[model samples]
Target: MDTVVQERLSTKIQKAVRKTMKYIVDEHDVRARRFLPRNDLESILNKKRLEQLFRELLSNEYASDTATAIPTGSDTGSAEGHDSSIEIDSAVDTCVKATIGTGNVSRRALLALFLYQPHTRLLSLYVEWLTSGHPRIRKPSYDDHEIPCDKSIPFTEGDLETLNIPFTNHGYIMDYQTIFTPMTIRKFTHHDFKTRDRLPFLGAKEKIKDGSSGTVYKTNIAPGHWEFKTSDGRFLPENPDTSMVVALKIFKTIEGPWGTRDAKEVETDFNIERELLDSLRKRNISHRMIMLHWGSFSVRDADGIPSYHALIFELATFSLEAFLKDEECYRIFTDKSPVLAGLVDIVEALHCLHEHLGFFHLDIKPENILVFVEPESVHSGSNHEEGRKLIWKLSDFGLAREKGSTRERTGHRLSSSYYSSQPSTLPATRPAGLYQAPEIQSSSSSQAGPGSDVWSMGCVILMVLASIIEGPEGVTDLSSKLEVFFLNAAGKQKLFYVRNDSHSW
Candidate 1:
């Protein structure tokens, strides 16, 4: 019996090691003429990212399993499943921490190994067992314990005080929740852009975009003088009143019993946005960005459960798509020079994003670009320079990622199709974009770098130019009519440039 147990343990360890290595290599250099001299594999694998990957794997594992899901409401469903999920989460967390503590392999190294081949059946089964929600053996004797509630959950005033998060019981979604802490709270300060008081303590007036994860609201912030409780418990007034409004983005929280199941994924998406915003801020590249987040706040639902999240951002007058649809602006965008000038501004912003910030706005359609029409144009109905003198900023960082990320990511993350005809409906199998780069469809590797952005930009410029020259109907028809011709011509031009000049496309 002892020998059998030992043999099983040894086999498991060997299998783990093999899976890790295979995932890391991922067979990227399968066509190498000879073995590469230098392979710095660790460059891609780092401790922080490795830990993140582990958390993701664990979250996915939990999400995929049906048994461990929490009950939907307070009155209905089984507490056993919720308890089981909690147990599994705790166990997995402990296991991962212990594994990382061992330091036999770096987190990045382990991640690379897993990514190379993914996990095999036997190893996956082993992991499933190791991270299972409950024991296979059911207890013959079980006792019922009272289900925990808001009052039952012991939280001290000192706890909130220690965190320095004010809880006015102001009926906000995030204030009442015991477990959650908004990611943006860590990034910004109280007085930063005067966002602390500017955020509304009340409910949203109207919802703008309702997505799978959350809703965007067209709400008003205080923009006026307000007082807040300081760490020393002093109520201090900051700034004078100004009537300024902002866009408030709110996320749905997992509520009832089953809510925790989906909340993790929602929180993950929210955190990604927060981290991206933090990166932008750290790089000091917020000037031309579409939306700048001031801070994050939590909102409480009717049940007084802190489930909803809100992020404050500068409100745009309108989207570029809206601008294009306006009959007043058609004359200005119709011309090449001013439209090209606007494109130059966009390019400058893109340069700041890609070159300086090392990020790519993966989803770069007209709707994602917001236009702040010049205040001077408020009264003027002029069709030339004044009409075109608008500022464009890129918004919606939901699908954005750092440059040179792996191409393993497969999804159509665009907001909505601008054209009436679907690109997916077209005969040729291509990426879901009229604005998508040519290489994104052709390249097997996942590196959609600055080049992809440039390609998308070219498409956007063409769309605006086409709309100017051909009209709105022409904008839709432009790609289908001329795509093949341009592609063929561009291919020839690429060869010509490569042959004649030192440059390569």
Candidate 2:
């Protein structure tokens, strides 16, 4: 039900954001300034990087989702029927699900209302979302939407033991499910330093392997680990110990005077990217969906150069493209799920994000996703066992936007980074155009809202489904046509997918 509701909610938000973008642009254009952002995402991506992103996004859809993914309740007590038996199925593509009643939400809502006066309004929003969805709920408050208990709920867990994730003593899935069960529902467990501050490391940084994100410095605390990233997005910091990371950024004070609005656009982009990543995590959709994991922040300076930046996730493996085409991938890898399952999972992830999270994965091609090449055999949620669950993570969040937050109406709706190369015979697509919602191109940008993400997701789907359809020569054209329908209003409203004859999925 949550997933279903999420899809509807994400769609509404997308529409709303696009609508808001039009309003902002219309108002701003009176001064004769460009209303929409310019195209730029792909031009910056080199051949190697583009290839890598294309592959990773399609790799086994991340460790957290592929193996034993389960949705835990929002309540403090054990979810109803935690021990009850559920009907087992034999299909690998289908999911196993059972309704045990809405859990902690009933209580989580009550507690949120009482503890935070501002959140009481959320009850109304949730109720509306629960019943009517985004369009019906005109006034929604982003201020207090967090779950009150870390505010995230566990997604579907396929097979717990397969993932090697830990379980609580009472036999509950630990990380995927609520950390505290229904019985433990206290209003203020988040405030307990012991719980929030407990570092989630299993080994020392010196002993643990550091992937692309680069060098991890061990802290004095036993087994505590921190990865250092320099100002440049890459991992080349000499010593990240003295770095200073900022929260709500404070303006720089210059000797002359304060800078103008234009001066702050860079900072705004940086903060927006960071906050956007944080927002993704807060939504419980997995940080991999938008960018590399943003873990901790710190300062480090060993040489004379002072590098200030964020402490983000250490990738388990290179991106899906490199891992796939780079000869190195074969030496260290094993395979299990049929190619079909891999394609299915990527579509599933994109679908969930588009339909549930309310944003666009602007770059839907294969290179942006990452496939972890870890060792160890694990069972998939479908009762199939494979060696080392593939962890396909999402990356490169620079171009993401909230639902309905597009600016097409003022005629400058194109995104930056979509085009940089000199155009060939067939002109290259603008970044916004690469994933542009065909319907929205004709309609107002504001009306395009969530469907833009749907359009991008469709491009991704076309890419992945290419692997399934027959005949390599004509696959691209056929897949594009097939997927274009998926983005149409009739498709979304009726929930149609001709291939599966699935109207509600």
Candidate 3:
């Protein structure tokens, strides 16, 4: 038994090392996007390895299952096969002679192994079993306790405190949860700008020509895109066509031309937003919404009040509105194209933002849903009816929030009907032109939770569906038509209660 376990351990680690190496080598490809973080694989693995111990989880059956999921023609629904981790028989440890360090070599060394031998699966399993729902069997009499939080667990107030996270209840859930969040994110107390310059990395990275955010640029990251942000009056990144390129988002210090009251609030909000995105990505929550890639802050002029924050993120194409518009003019393949697949992508992203990520995407317009119509993205949109895998990425986290990250100063002037959360944020008025939410009279960015964003998304969906129905032979030019339809739709009383806020807004 000891020999078998040891062999299993060696095989698992060896496989893990090789698997990690593969991702490291081919780090830029999309399919190579594993759940593990590229920069700190060993640490994440060591923390999550325990969930594999009592089952075939560490075995190739698990990893290959997700990657090479063979679809059985039958509709049994268990296409993943009846063989799941839960079905594995418990390996009762009857005591082995001269065992070679199995099971975190006893939980005492778990934390040490997590930091030191980060690639060590043994420690990861120990931590997970103690916290996850797998339910660690404690006594031979079947007294099973789901590894609830205790003193030695991986999650606790101690961990949150260690992480420097504030505002929490307890337990070691992700930072978004009450488990508490550490503050590695930046707080731009000082508003200053550096020299203006074009980011060299943007030119070197692969360019993504997705109209809305402008051409998306990607770099060789640990299986992700490295984005940069800019504020050239365009919500999109400033590309090589302009001097500053690179990163996902950039903030111009000047608060438009008119409203500059809570400029500090605006700068702080943006900085916190960018920093929060980076922090979330670190937690490895890849449900659907955009996570952070990389970020930096710099100023161009000598005495610019608010500096330029350059950010870089994974590449994605045009917005939903843009896609619909383009489809309206130029035929984007058949109706059975990856377009339908985008529906699933959209809902999945919505669900994650609302339910899992514990935040709201206040700006959930069609433009927010980035599309990737590249050749590789679609196996064959023409003939491959079921092979429409246009991977949609949710980007622009300028308005995302954790469960309780809304207390900061936001620059939004609210109307009367705005929710409490929305009104509380300091008013950072929008442009005089842009259309406001129906209930919102003035240019107010009342921070709605995920539900509010859902209201916006619901509006987008109705407009798209309306276009498809009203158009001649289905709305072919989705990209071009989306914005016009939405702007028009916003004015109309399209906000159905079901589609609108269900939560206490």
TM-scores for every candidate against the unseen true structure = 0.45, 0.33, 0.42
Q: How do the candidates rank by lDDT, highest first?
A: 1, 3, 2
Which residue segments of model 2 deviate by more than 4 Å? 1-263, 284-292, 296-311, 327-339, 377-386, 404-448, 465-505
Question: How many steric clashes between backbone atoms does each model show?
Answer: 19, 72, 64
> What is the lDDT for 8 in model 2?
34
Q: What is the lDDT of residue 86 in candidate 1?
A: 69
Pairwise lDDT winner, candidates 1 and 3 = 1
By summed lDDT, which 10 consecutive residues of candidate 1 come out lowest? 30-39
| Candidate 3 least-lDDT 10 residues | 176-185
lDDT of 1: 0.46
lDDT of 2 by residue, 1-505 (tens): 0133223333433332232133333543322211111011112222333223222221211221334434666452244223211101111001110001133232331212211222222323233222222232222333223322222333234333332224331133232132112111111011111221222221223222221212333322111122334457533322223322211111121222222223234334445555666677788655343444434332223332212333344344455545444433343333425334555666667766666775555545445665655545554555233455566656555455555443221112323222114111111123124444443332232223334455655665554444334323334455355442332344522111342222335
Could you tell which candidate, 1 or 2, scores higher by lDDT? Answer: 1
Model 2 RMSD, rounded to 1 decimal? 29.3
Task: Show model 3 residue runs off by greater than 4 Å.
Answer: 1-198, 201-248, 255-258, 261-266, 289-291, 300-306, 328-330, 376-388, 413-447, 470-505
